[model samples]
Target: MNVLLIGSGGREHALAWKLSRSPLLGQLFIWPGNPGTASLGENIPLPVDDHRAVSDLIHQKGIGMVICGPEAPLADGLMDFLADRHPDLALIGPGRSGARLESSKEFAKEFMLRHGIPTARYRSFGSREAEEAISFARSLGLPAVIKADGLAAGKGVVIAQTREETETEIRAMLEGRFGQASERLVIEEFLSGIEFSVFVLTNGDQYILLPEAKDYKRIGEGDTGPNTGGMGSVSPVPFADAALMDKVRDRIIEPTLRGLKQDGIPYRGFIFFGLIRVQGDPFVIEYNCRMGDPETESVMIRLESDLLQHCLDCHQNELNPGSVRVSSSHAATICLVSGGYPGDFEKGKKIEALPQTQPEEHIFFSGVSSKDGQLVTSGGRVFAVSCLGQDQLAALDQANRLADLIQFEGKYFRRDIGFDLK
Candidate 1:
């Protein structure tokens, strides 16, 4: 089957790599893909918002399936547009209603509450409710979490440590700190726990859980400083044992699926559950309509199933518990970023060179572009170095080593990826 993957990031590159290996695949096409993805398939320079152009190309290329790798396209009703215009085009993504789980934090929290899913206490507020939002934050106390109600490229959340800080953040958000994304806000009570990511492939009621992963979201070492998209990730999370996984499935995942079904929402795609374990119990932190970046680089490395087959199963509404297969081997990914990432940074810096990688190690580009015959930085996150190993320690070691090999003027990466598991 011919597939058209949307997005230009580490997650899409990893998906492109895995999907390329499937024998069921004929040709792969990436829309606005990076250099890493360009190596695996034909990269198309189509704008994501140009639905007419995308539709025309799909028909022209006879693309069998459309796999959306990021949340923005999903939130923009890309699936609905395709479904309405070209009903025969197999798509691996939820429509706009289902995408609300990620596009709007307020909607997700309310949906969780309505469905009795385990999550932190949160109150959604419009800009006019700034005073109420502040009062709610004070009630929750310091270390409160202030999140922009709409998507803000993963940087919409702020973990304020004091009442004053919380108030200030609330005002900033309401006053257009994150533009229209912050017109509304959701204030959450800080839940102390370690965070991890859970991905599931679902076709409405039927679903298959993929490998679990934990990603470091902070921009600095020791998990200090502001949050970035993701600095690093590890699959087969050491702390997510079977017992805790049972709780997560029953208390969080099951309830979420049931809620979606009961709400009459049509869903057929990846559901990324942002979870936090508090005293061995899992609570949902957020939901993503698509796979998580950096996490995908790690999780895809450990996926043993044919990626194309799984997507087909979901599209045909045949997804089952046994449809997914994952390797027991550990996987790790270290994200190399431009210096001063998650903040201001320069782009188009020449990439002097990249070291040769072992068979077990791989480099997935995120924010890189080929200029004239040389690669250069184009975004904050530059590349994700991924490696598979017999154990988590070995995987981290290999990934860290390979990450250090990539050379660029402002290259920087956290040396302590997956350190907590150690």
Candidate 2:
């Protein structure tokens, strides 16, 4: 069937690549897609936020389904709009009420608390409650966590090692450091452990689990600097064995899905469980309304199923968990960013020397566009390089090789993608 894929990023590119291989697919269209996705399908220049324009295009192209790749459009109620405008059109992703789990940290905390989901303890405060928030952080002691209640493009959460840093971050968040997105703050007790991502394709009550992945969020090597959207990711996390997954399904994922059904929240799309493994048990750190970038790149690389068919099953609430398939091989994805990324950075520099892909290696573009018929950087993150191999280290090695081959004026990438695990 004809499909409309939303957003423009590496995640969308990977999904486009996989969807293009589906025999069930007739035509694929990407909204404002990048150079990478442009190769796989038609890239329409329509803005995703313009619901009317999007509906117009859907009607024109006879698009049967829309797969949302980013959180913003979903959180904006794009799915709800489509459901109302075209009742027959298959839609992926959640509406605003369900997206609240990701858009509002305070709302997510409340949901977790109400559902008995294992998560870190948190207290919400508004702009006027800066002093109260600080007092709460002080009581939590050193290494306290301060989070902006709204989406900040993955940079809203900060782990403060000292009381001074904690106070400053809390005040900054409530004082509009991130503008309206940070008008409120969620002070959470810090939990130290290895963090990973869990993706679920759900239709309110029933769901299908995707491969678990671990991503490096900090921009620097060894995870030392400020957080970026993501640095790199590896699928089939070395530490999340069967036992841990069992705990995650029972203690976290199951409860979360049940809670959503119980609360009457309309949802049908990807749920990203940002989880941390503390002392061999899983505890949720956060949630996202859609698939996580960089993680999607690696997960797609390792998936051995017809993603389009699975997406259709999920949309129709006819998914059979036994039908899902994943490759035995490991996959890794490393991001290429502008030199001054996670801060101020320049764009539009001509990109060059991208290598040809082999059998298992792939390059997916994100913040890149064709400028005067030549590829050029368009955002902080330029693209991603991914590969499959016999093992995790081998996959990382091949992905890093591809990362090195791609060239731009100020291209920067972390060489040690899976370093901590090594």
Candidate 3:
């Protein structure tokens, strides 16, 4: 079937790779895709934000299915628009209303609280409540998490360790340091524990869980330094054993889907949960409506099922849990980010010594572009090197080896991506 995938990032590259391998697929197209996707299928030069243009392209091409890889367009009602324009085309993503779970943190926090989903206690505050928020933080004490209510491209949350730091964060967020994304803030109690990412493909009621993954969010090794989109990730997280996986599905995923349905927003497509394993139980840290970037690179490598078929089933609300399958092998991905990332960083720097072609080991390109026929860094996180093996250690080793082979001036990555497992 003819398929159209959206977005321009490493996650989209991985999706393209997986979908291109599906025997059910006849043709694949990626909109405004990155360099990596250009190698896999037809890279259409359609603006992601232009809804009408995208619809026209889909109709002109007779596209049968559309898979949205990122959250921005989904939150902007792309699915809703497509459904309105072409009721016959199947779209794999939540509509604008369902997207509130990711686009508005305040709404998600409140939704979780109302539905009794396991999550950190949080209080939403507007700019007028700045002083009250500071007072609330002082009451909760130090080590609080301050989050921007809206999307900020993954750089809007601050883990403040003290009252002074919390106060400063509130001021910056309210003052528009993160622009309108911080117009409202959600102060959360910091929960201590190991973090894991859980991905669920849901067709409103039925859901199929993918292998669990652990992501390194901090920019520096040893889990120190500032937060970033993601540094690296390893799949089949040891902590998410069969029992814990069941608990995640029963306690978290089920309730969330039920809640969304009760709220009149039947969610379909990928639902990502940012979870913190506190003690023996799991508490959600956040919700991402789409697949996580570097995390997807690891998870997709372990998937033994037909990626396109599963996505199509979810879109049609006919998902069969038995159809989903995953490999026993483990996978890992290390992201090579630009120098001074999660802060000020130079863009358009020339990248050299890159592998001649996409590695057979699963490499996803992120922030890169071809300028004058030369690949150059275009964003904070540039590329992801992913590998699969019998276990996490071997997978990590392969990922690191590939990472070392590619080089550019001021490129940096964490040396201890999956060290916690050791």
Off by over 4 Å in 2: none
RMSD of each: 1.0, 1.0, 1.5
Report lDDT (CA) for all predictions.
Answer: 0.91, 0.91, 0.89
Lowest summed-lDDT stretch of 10 residues in model 3?
353-362
Per-residue alpha-carbon lDDT of model 1 for 62-129, expressed as tens digits? 99999999988899999999999887888999999999999999999999999999999989999899
Q: Which ten residues in a row have the lowest lDDT in candidate 2?
A: 315-324
- Per-residue lDDT tens digits for candidate 2, residues 81-182, read 888999988888898899999999999999999999989888999989988999999888879999998988887888899888988898888889899889
Q: What is the lDDT of residue 264 in candidate 1?
A: 97
TM-score of each: 0.98, 0.98, 0.97
lDDT tens readout by residue for model 3, 181-293: 99999998889898899998898898888878899989988999888999999998998888887788888999999999898996788999999889988899999998998
Model 3 whole-model lDDT (C-alpha atoms): 0.89
Error of 2 at 41 (Å): 0.7
